[model samples]
Target: MNSSYEQELCNKKLETILVIDDSPTNLEILHDVLGSAGYEVLVEMDGASGIEQVEGNPPDLILLDVMMPKIDGFETCRRLQANPSTKHIPIIFITALTEAEEKVKGLALGAVDYITKPFEQEEVLARISLHLKLRKLNLELDKQKQELEIRVAERTSELSQTLNELKQTQLQLVQTEKISSLGQLVAGVAHEVNNPIGFISTNLHYANQYIEDLLILVRLFQKNCSNPGSEVEEQIEAMDLKHIDKDLPKLMSSMKLGTDTIKGIMQSLRNFSRSDGENKKLVDIHEGIEATLMILQHRLKAYPKRPAIQVVKDYSVLPKVQCYPGQLNQVFMNLLANAIDVLEESMIENQYLNRKESTFINPKIRIATTINKYQVIVKIADNGKGMSESVINEIFQPFFTTKPEGKGTGLGLSISYQIITENHGGNLQCISSPGEGTEFLIQIPF
Candidate 1:
């Protein structure tokens, strides 16, 4: 009893083999050989019982007999191979028939190899060990395959995300270049306009004085010598001298006003296009906002379809801020321009629906500014069809836009957001909802 217990304990540490056969003599012989070779052998007398034993307690290898009572080894092998849980277990067929056709049939039925009826102890042990090693190697390969596939999937996702970021960076560079080129062009145009305006303004001042002196001389002559000659009187009446004397001064004043307005516009253009290079400068924040509004004046004028969009300014006195002047101007321009666009669209919609009388109030943009010790705040609000919460969430994302495809490049707000948050270390926030209107709040450090 002690020897049997010790043997059982030793077998527990060895590889287990399940042998299925009908002949007790063959089972006993094979079992003794496998047991002596350091393998734990399990025996079953029939194919059905063997299948049950395998399901109840799995083993490392299976030995099936070719000739059996109820079910032959072929049918048994087929049954085990058909089961998913048993399919991977290695099966070696034991048979007495040495026919080539019979061997081929046994191998085809998923048996790893055939053991002749007169079992060679060495051959049986060797075949079982070889198939066991192959099974272990296959499991390892499958695990490695799974790990490689997971790694490949993770790498693909990372690369895809990187590709999208690169695309956005490229587009942003293109946008920056375009803005730079446009600024240069605007600066050049403003410079050109300045010269012509200077000439007209200077000459108009002298021309006004000269015309005034000539008028004064004529008045002196008319006052001192009323009857200088009949020809002079006739000429004065024919030329309508009184009307010219009164209207000429007013016309010159109007001309002067017109030139002054043009000069102001040119100055605003120059201010808006001022490039600050790589350095910051102390600048009037209000000046930047004014310049942007001046540039967008044409869009604010009363159109045939709608009344003029009103801009109400509630500016608080603010000290000059040290910042990138050109970029700050760009942010203001983007925000104001977006407000104008939305207002214009809303106006058109109102007119098309003929709701101007009831629903559409005057389209207006309200701009307010305030300053504290830590930061300066600017607010731009418009009464227009606003965005949903979902849209507001993605507003700062590059390439996100609501404008029609060709009408907008969708870079303005994203670039503006970067300029405020990343460039100036400022904060930009939006508040909006459907049909309620939209408001953008900008806060910049002192």
Candidate 2:
């Protein structure tokens, strides 16, 4: 427990009692009686001294003598009551006056109760015990109220934080959906343009070859002819010899290559934009994994002296799951991309320490899929630097990412979590440790 809390408990355990009287015998009796009852007793000889003591260090209860030299009990009680700081302390008057008016006056002066001269010991003890219990109860009540207020404030703070996080996650999801829709439209346009491009590319290739042959024939004719016959001149003239033959052929060849490259790009776009729906089909998960691998091929390839990490597929024979294939493909894409990022960070760290000469040994990514009686499970495991216990615990929380700013939006796992749990009625979980690599297990109902 915190030191402040422990200190509070100790303070609560001790209760102080203040006894005010002019007579030494009376003060001694009050102190001894209260002290035996487990209260710390403070004694004052006169009303003036008692008021000072109460103001300086307030006690839980005060026992005051009504009659005293110089400053009297009524004036002291009035002083204590006037100040808000010491006003609430329970005060009982001890007096020798036996008249009804004297008792009435003491009670009117804010004394809670009165004890006449030659006080009964049992009665004095009983009244003190009763008032002390009441004081302690009041203190407990105040403490409880303060504690309740603190708890309410803390809960409100947590709820506000959660609400803010939810709003941010919603905004990111909207942006991602918009981008995905745009990608689909671009893919469709690219696919439609591919057919015309293919035809144009083929035509350009054939035209270039024809142009080359005509150029060779013209050169041969020119070399062979001197002051040639009219038939040869007619033939050269008919072939349009004055035209820029070399330039035209080169232009057509360049156009062909350009169109062919565009066609390939379009094909890649089409594959990437494939949609997921409620349509259930027999899908080979391995094919989707391979497609995702191809999409990220550039990232996997090493540059300069860096060694590329190998991807190992260990797919088990399993029944096809009845679910949206495209979404599953996206899950694979995200997992593989995250693994690549971790591995890249490791490689960069190694390079920073002048260790670039050392080659990475068996830096690999493994993906496996299997089907049980009720569910199909896909496990994507990576052998990159793993997460600690804290990271692993909060990995699925929305907008929680280990990647640096601008490198990640931190919504991939959050969205993936929503998709698996809400959309598909499945579960997504992670198994990881510090040195041991992480594995995400995704289970979809059959």
Candidate 3:
């Protein structure tokens, strides 16, 4: 026998059979028949006594006799089925009552089988064997089902853990790329600041030396001007004092203008840099945009092939928006950079053709912003060669770039979309077609 069969057979043995009958003759016959089949026999003369015996020590199967005094076999079976501990034991009804209706009643009351009087010993043995086999099969199925459920739960937990790890790895890669882009932006800003500062330093030194000369003349005038002196007048004439007086104010004004330029550039740099703050801030959207433009100004400079790209700003005064300024600046940088690159490519093509009046002769970028009742809208449009339908559809997919392999990581627009839509509650959309220019529309809630 298989281990499964041995386990059930050892545990439930088929060794003990209980006989309940009022007639002594019937009881003796059953005892002898069951005993000859290598089973131990226990007898109860009444239904109540049989129930008592079964409750004391539950058997794998019970042989119940009907039509007994006090409580009947049906009542005994009902009592056994009521207890949680004894409910699963199979009950077979053995009765002298030949009425088919009585047998049906016994079976309906939780009896597994019904044996009529004048039953053959071989038939009794065969029916008992069948019911025991059915009982054992049910136990095996239940055990297997529990084991399958445990395995499925373990696999599900492992899959969930792996998915979380993948997401973490993706986030790390995004941050690394962001830092690399920031370095390029900083270099551009430094170049812008260096131009004005360089001139300011030289102008201040010249202004200081001019002041020393003027002061010496004033000292001479105060000390010796009570009496007229020919040499003093001669010295003033040689120095061109009148001309110095006339140009001194203009020099100071020029210096002031240079200082103001440096200050504006520094402020723009601060605004762009401070946007990476941990907390959201109420900020002037236009200021953030101007800062981004400043960072990108170098890209708009004229080259031999093309004049400077014209930028038309149509800004509407609106309420300040609460947002992560640094992140929004990143989105602006991405969109504007793409526009400038596309325009440059077109300019190169136009130069090669030597068509001074080509369709994209003077490439232009237009930025317009407006506010409705609940949202702020920004549109950045470029008059360069526009994208095709396929390019537009896939633009926001991660690592999907049209630029040459090393020139573009394809993550710019995709990361920008994540910043606007996921980081802040906003929408970024692209509008373009072949031979037409491209427009990026951004909307953020108030």
Name the candidate that leads on TM-score.
1
Q: lDDT by residue for model 1 over 1-446, one digit each (tens)? A: 37887687666667899999888888888888887777789999998999999888989999998888898889988998999998888899888999999999888988888889787788888888899999889989999999999999999999989997886686568657866887889878877888889999999999999999999999999999967899998999999999999999999999999999998888887788777788899999999999999999998998775788899999999988989888888899999999999998887788778854525659999999998889999999999999999999999887889999898878889888888888899999999999999999999998
Alpha-carbon runs more than 4 Å astray in model 3: 1-244, 355-359
What's the TM for model 3?
A: 0.54
RMSD (Cα, Å) of candidate 2? 14.7
Candidate 1 vs candidate 3, TM-score winner = 1
Candidate 2, after superposition: displacement of residue 91 in Å? Answer: 15
lDDT of 2 by residue, 1-446 (tens): 57776677567666787888889998888777766656689999898889989989999889888889988988999889989999889898888888999888877877788877799878988888788788778879989999999999999999989997776579457535844784678676876796788778777778778888988987787788777889868976897666665476667767877887677566544554466645666666666676677778888887666677788777888776666566666677778899988887777766676664644455788888888888888898888778999998888877789988888877778777776776679999999887688899999897
* Model 1 regions more than 4 Å off: 1-157, 355-361
Off by over 4 Å in 2: 1-172, 175-179, 188-193, 200-268, 277-284, 354-356, 359-361
Candidate with the larger lDDT of 1 and 2: 1
- Against the true structure, what is each candidate's TM-score? 0.68, 0.55, 0.54
lDDT of 2: 0.78
Per model, state how many residue pairs clash.
Answer: 0, 0, 1
Candidate 3: residue 61 Cα off by (Å): 43
Worst 10 residues of 1 by lDDT: 352-361
C-alpha lDDT of residue 303 in model 1: 72
Error of 2 at 287 (Å): 3.6
